[model samples]
Target: MKKYFLKLYQYNAWSNKRVLGTLQRQNVNDPKILSLMGHVVAAQFLWLHRIKGLPPPDVKLWGEYSLDQLLKLSEKAGKEWLEFVESNDNFDRQLTYTNYVGEPYTNNVEMIMVHLVNHSSYHRAQVAMLLRQKGFEPINTDFITYDRVITGQLKE
Candidate 1:
């Protein structure tokens, strides 16, 4: 189970860097794009803090960050998540955390890990659509693409 989640985190980090690189290469500093990416990075921190029994950071979920800021934050969050997954072995451990709306919920570590990746993927799709509408091609961040590239089946 730990191995599986580590692979997922690896994919997540790779895909995030791809998206960030695409945005940089396309010279896309769109507010919406930055905001979505910021939210993704912020949510990763939030969930990690919850899992680690730490307080949440002072960050706005929908905040619009500069492209450079997003790049740094995304990279930091990815590293932290990867390290957390590597150090932990109990994915089935349940955690209780409060939601943004002040609601309480309990979920196991596995579910939260899955949710973080899925949440990023969902927003990345939105970022891709926005880029396409603006006459730019988005980089492929699909899991299979990541797998292939890592395995040397496709050149990155």
Candidate 2:
């Protein structure tokens, strides 16, 4: 499980760098793209906080981050997550938390970790679609595609 989380984190960092490079080259300053990225960051931060029993951040604050700032924030978050997984010894994966809507939710540690990755992937895909609509092709966010390109893996 730890290994899987690490792979997901690596994929996220690589994909983030790719998207940042694309946005820089295209000079994509679309407000919607920025907004979507902000949501992605907010979602990650919110879950991390939940996992750590920390208070949630103000979602509105994410708007203060420009694309470049968001990229840096994402990198920071990635590093923080890696350090967290490295340092934690408790392997008990079960924890429960309520959602923003006051709904009951139960998730083990592994499930929470997977949720973090999947949640970001989903929002990033939306951002990519938005970028394409605005005439910019964002980097592919597919996990297998990422592994194949980054590791030069041949299809079986």
Candidate 3:
């Protein structure tokens, strides 16, 4: 499960970098794209910490940051997430956490992990659409493509 999530994370990081570069090269002036990426990262941090029974992250919204800065922050966040996964074994699952809507949810660690990936994937798709609406070419981030890139073969 960790490996799967890690693969998704790595692919996400790559896709974001591609989009960020496109925005930079095209000289995009809107900061909302960066803000959206920040939201994605912030949400991941909040959910992962919640699942791990840790304090939530403090980011309320995305802020202005150069592409390099955002990438660095993402790297840091990814490292923390990886460490959290490393500390837990498969038996440590089913954490209880509250959602923003004040609903109680009991989620296994693996489910929560997949949720994080899917959550990010959904938002990243939003970012891509937002970019396309603004006339930028967003990178294609299909999971199969990522697997092919990682394994050096076209995966079915």
Candidate 4:
């Protein structure tokens, strides 16, 4: 489970950098795209904080951040997730946390991790489409595409 989480986190970082690079090529003027990207990192931090029994950071869901700022935030989240995955042993460990609407829920580690990655992916797709609508071609951030680049023969 740890190895699986590590792989997912690694892939998440790789995909994030690709998307950030594409967004960086633009002038960082699109508020919609910026909010989506910012929310990715903000939600990651919020979840980590919740899992660690800490208060959420002063980041809003739709916060505006420049691409460079988001790049730094993305790197921070990746490093934190990698460390957490390596340190934790029980994937089924349960955690209780409150959502933005003050609704509380308990979830196992595996589910939380899956939700984190899937949430980012959902927003990344939105970012890609937003770029497309603006006459720009977004890079392919698909898991299989990343896998092909990292493992030419599918060694994993």
lDDT of 2 by residue, 64-114 (tens): 568778788778777877777777766467778887777878788777788
lDDT (Cα, 0-100) at 37 in candidate 1: 90
Poorest 10 consecutive residues by lDDT, candidate 2 = 56-65
lDDT of each: 0.92, 0.75, 0.71, 0.87
Q: What's the residue-level lDDT of 156 in candidate 3?
A: 26
Ranking by lDDT: 1, 4, 2, 3
Tell me the RMSD of model 3 versus the true structure.
Answer: 3.3
lDDT of 1: 0.92
Error of 2 at 5 (Å): 1.0
User: For this target, which candidate reaches the highest TM-score against the unseen true structure?
Assistant: 1
Full ranking by TM-score: 1, 4, 2, 3
Per-residue lDDT of model 1, residues 47-133, tens digit only: 998889898887779887999998999999999999998998888988998988889999988899999999999999999999999
Q: Which stretches of candidate 2 lie over 4 Å from their true place?
A: 58-64, 89-92, 101-104, 152-156
Q: Estimate TM-scores for all models.
A: 0.98, 0.83, 0.78, 0.92
Residues 19-87, candidate 4: write the lDDT tens digits. Answer: 998877766468898899999989988988888788887778788887778999989988998898888
lDDT of 3 by residue, 64-152 (tens): 66666666767677777767665655624678888766798887777777777787788778878988898887777777777787787
